[model samples]
Target chain A: METSAAGLEKAIKAIKIGLSLPEQDHLHRELEELLGWLEPLLAFNTGETEPLLFGHEAVNVLREDHPQEGRLAELQEAAPNFAGGFYLVPKIMD
Target chain B: MELRKTTVRQAADAVWKGEITAHQLIEKTLKNCSVLNEGLNIFTYLAGIDAVEQAKAVDQKIKNGEKPPLAGIPVAVKDDLCYGVLPTGLGSPAFSEFISPVTAAAVERLMEAGAVVIGKTNLDDMGQGSTTLSSPNGPTVNPWLAGRTAGSAGAAAVATGVCMLAVESDSGGALRQGASHCGVAGLRPTTGRVSRHGLNAHCSSFARVGITAFSGEDISEVLDLISGFDERDAATAVCREGISEIIKAPGSKDITIGYPVTAFDYLEPELREIFEQARERFAEGGYRIEEVDLGLLREGLLAYYVIAMAEAFSNHARFDGIRFGKTAEADSLEEMYEQSRAEILGREARRRSIFGAFLLSKDNYGRYYRQALKIWEMVRQEFETVFERCDLLMLPAARSLPRSLEGESGFLEGWSEDLYCAPVSLSGMPALTIPAGQVDQLPVGMQLVGPPFSEKMLLAVGSASGSTGK
Candidate 1:
């Protein structure tokens, strides 16, 4: 259950959460505590049980293919910046 | 003395009879809200002007001799809900300015039924914690006790008489635990029983839009209006007949209520005594009380955290800072995503998101995520077996009464406190928490859990307890 510093850094990077050195130390400690909390699940023999992806009894629910207008204008208005109904972000290409 | 003190049904009756105008009720509710917010911090956003206008419209309808079900009752929704008029912060700084263009289906149904939303109340940021502590505005203080966590701002608003009804959500017992702490009635319907169309997703599969109100009558009435199929939420099934009929009819006299003694080992002496007294009442009233074994359910705490964290990380990936809210000033897109999430997302959220990422990453996916899902299936099956012996299971809503908010470390402690209620969520069953009685001045509550889509039976049991109202 002990999460190494390297493993913690990989988790933060993979999750795209930027943590400062101090925050990283705090979170690393917290993660180790949380992993310790999760120890009970590791002891169970779960090989026979089927993994439940959905909690409900329903299978895949399909609707008819239909084109419908959405609230694009309202969504654009709420965004920080948008042009031609597309969300604006910082430059990704050089 | 305040009109806001009336329950939803009582106020709606008055509005229909012209005893009070909707506008007058909203004004009184706003006044009470101002007073309550001074010490309790009950609301994050008060719908002052819009509420008045909405009330006036209800008054106009009343003048024309039409009656709506909720008719001018003041209501508060949890801030995490996606209502368009007020900006949703989800208790996080990242969403402080986020305007939800779409309204939730349940909220829309309430408005259509003539309920006026007075404000949005605070919750743990993004509903991550059971306590209402993670909000940037700070935690909601319990009105019943000074130092104890007040539950959610929505629960506080109802208990403090600022709003007649409060709309709260539950993934892992947020609404029920809040109700238990605050001495109110909260009902979490079976998952997909109430449409999840307008709710902000945390653990999408586990989360359900529920409500907190003064009485089981109020909660059941709201459930009747909102619990049905929605085209927007494909998971919603066509509701079975007999909900209204069942609520009207008396619950079966020969009912067998299950008590899971093993699951409630953490309960304190005072709360345990109160629970025992209530159990004695049921036994004296000719009801069979069975002690059911919670085999797989004993591991509910670990399974809930694992599944919820994984789903939350996936659901929250939409908060890229480019879509809405304040974005970080950065040179590149990658830096923007990282800096924005890091800067705005709070400690609890960041911890969970990373934990989720770690659980789902590479070999860890099969090791943790899959294993938890299997345990989830086992928990559901165990509940199915338990239900075969009893009509419904009666349990405490919380392990202990509300704890002090002045503590140094509340994050880890809060997660552990959800043990009593998380098992219900893991099984996707219906549960209603009603204030059973009090231990001294503070209130203690008990939860009644039923099989899936058995809301009417649960509400009947709640009503029979005679604790849903003052």
Candidate 2:
């Protein structure tokens, strides 16, 4: 079950969005190094990883706004760059 | 006797028999620590005053005609475990000033059993590296030779002390590898043989509390006191009619030993020579030797890195410059985390944390962590096959002697030695390392491994090797 090239793109996009931090570049370099080492071992599996298994689909649903209020605010405060309910970043997306 | 070489058993017996007061014994041990510790860096902190107080209490207890198993026996505590009054770092700065609110169940159990918690010993930063160089305090060198321990300094913590024994923990090859370097005895107990309530896990699946000691008697006696099941550590099994029971089962002139059929290719000539001689000795001691395949031993390191790093990233996430020790000294919260990450974390720890985060990340979990565990299960099955034919497995503790500081090798070269020992850890089997001989001016060791809960068989084989004399 190798990974589909399309699926790998989606995963890369989703992951790139999540690696927000001051040390993102450090992490980026590390990711490249790690992938360089593990990607070969992974190629055989990626080839077998695709075509989707049962319960493998992601649901594009949003949660109900039931006042699950904001620990995210406090946690965000701990991050290096946040501005007015938004986490500042290198603007990966326009 | 000089404090550096005596076993804790002899000291404890003396303290118990009113032959020496606990304070005097502690003073001698502290003196030894102060002098030898310069070369070793074993103790992260030596509690002269605390040890004196503990000694006083033990002396009082002995006078009151009550004796506990480790009563008055001096033992060094690993710096990573919480010691009530001593500071613990888990090998990082985030928790550097964070003293324990309570003792870890394992240390408490050891103290209750009459062992004096002498001082905190050094460890790899965040328990992330195979070498103690990862420690922010500094690398703990092999006491027998002046360098970072071949696999890790886990030996420097306990065996370097003049005390009878010392406590240690293993998440991979921490105990076995360190003992191999120090040329002393070390035990990696069955995973649940003790408790982890107080210890930090780099990877929960492979972690276990262990002991490094002067002799097999010290190893078993200390383990007996700490090995029982604890409610706090859910993984510990009941005092099974299991492995410990077999250790006590007796009669041992003819035991079967399993040798690594391929470990020789990885071992240096000196170690290969020593291991071959050790096998001959084992055969002469009336044990049948069998060669077996454990390709799993090689995968053990890779799998261990994946598992340990993944868990470590989680365990360390709690120290996000919030709540505890010192603040991350950043103007903003995110800056705080970056600062915290940079300041207290070492090169190995940072590398491991990033790897851990990636392995456990939403995208990579299936490919890394999950597959690693499957490999571990296969290794366990491999162990099962081997044990059916042998009473214990014997192998060189490492590929070479304790390495030098400016090694002809790198940190990975240092960790590569643990390949033989770490698999035993991943399989959660009990193993011990004893000094086989010296190689090129440094001590080398041989490891004896047994099935889960097979401490008795491991030590019986170890004892027969005549490596246990104090």
Candidate 3:
């Protein structure tokens, strides 16, 4: 079944992507094709089987909650803007 | 001396015996990089001077009468692995300049064991595809056949003798597929067998740092150096010792190997011939082969793709140009994110994220995402049952010889290349691919899969099958 153009537009909005109308149209076609490929999964009745969230069998590892020295310098370098050991971003209060 | 062709064990022995200096080996490897990169385009970033310095350090250690496990061996790493000195591109334009401030635990162990980091090899952008064609850098060409896809850039680097060992990752058979295409051996250890602390998150649960080399013994040497528990990566298994010791002479035990027709139905004529010959050889060697029904395991590709796309959607949400990676100028925060991602991510990455969002959307979550996970669990359970009756499972690596690079658009869909290996990944089991033999001059590989923590037994079986020529 073809994905409705309106449905794809809703999906694009929900996903928070930036695309022109032409690009959206192109993506609509691709999404429809991909959905068709994914159609087989919907047909299988999974019943009460639980999902395997993590593939490995290891137990959850816990560490202390105390603050420790982190890679602050590296984080600052990767940040878009930093000054006086603080991150700068568009004003949220305004 | 064909220094480039020197195996991991041979190089260490030579360096220890003072027959060759690590500096000379690094020089030869750098020269190989220059001559081969034109045809194969293997590495995304070469550690030219930095690699030499590391090699010099190894040579100094050798002169002092110390021998490291991988002494002075040149190794290639996938671009996504975090190396503080190397600029990690992740094969995407977005991360072209992203230098990791930290190094992977596995890589740290390798360096400690005396392996020299020669270069960072290319990969599909964010490891989204099997064919290594999605890179903003040109697709890696197969060294064996010019203009054919180098299934994994690291695989090509190892095959062409540019690097003696390669560190790579596999989500959906990228490691095995590339190894098969390039006529080398690659092993994807159990999901948590190696640390993912320094590895980029792409299909996080399914992705693992895999080892690649020309032979099984070389792969085993590297695997022993890297596999262990890490406090940083919470999912790592408890430290297992003596993994390298298991690569001993192939045992004489009569092994039972299970073959499923569902997996073999897609094999091309040439690969079928190779598969038959391998089976005959195993039989002559006194191993028993039993054919089994794959059942739900046949749906492995669909389940793997759905889960991978959904995870990718969440994993890539961090790259909005706000924190890291290349950012585009825009007025609003959302616009900055949208524009930067659209400009930076490749077509496959973008499509996957969108499809992933669609799968997890309110109306589709139960129908798509949950269903795929259920199937994932079912496939795992089915394999658990199969393993009970057989010592190992055998299947063809690629359905056919790799497709030509020119005859196709760079985009790969349906993921047919991963048909054989993804099921093992989904179950988080270990699979070792051996270059079983060649078909029509193209290499063909057979995978040996066992239950979790079966690396030693799997390698022993592979070694015994004459896959490593040990």
Best candidate per DockQ, number?
A: 1
Q: For model 2, how big is the CA root-mean-square deviation?
A: 7.9
Instruction: Give the TM-score of each candidate.
Output: 0.96, 0.83, 0.94
How much DockQ does model 3 earn? 0.54
TM-score of chain A of each: 0.78, 0.27, 0.70
* Model 1 docking category: medium
> What is the DockQ (computed on Cα atoms) for candidate 2?
0.06
Number of the candidate with higher TM-score, 1 or 2: 1
How high is the CA lDDT of each candidate model? Answer: 0.81, 0.67, 0.79
Give the alpha carbon lDDT tens digit for every residue of B258-317 in model 2: 887786778767678888888888777667788987766666666666677777676656
lDDT of 3 by residue, B24-65 (tens): 988888988988887788988899999899999998888888
**lDDT (C-alpha) at residue B86 in model 3:** 87
TM of chain B, each = 0.96, 0.93, 0.95
Model 1, B1-470: lDDT tens per residue? Answer: 35435566777998999888899989988988888887888788888999999999999998888899999988898888888898787888778777799888888989999999899988887777778888788889999988888776777788887787888789888899888888888999887778888788778878889988877777877887887877788667545332332232334556888987776667777778888898888887667899999866558778888989888888878776776556799887888889888766687778888888888877578878999989999889989999899888988888777878886764667787888788889999889988888876778888989887777877777877747535
True contacts kept of 3: 0.54
Choose 2 or 3, whichever is better by DockQ.
Answer: 3
Cα deviation at B5, candidate 1, in Å, is 5.9
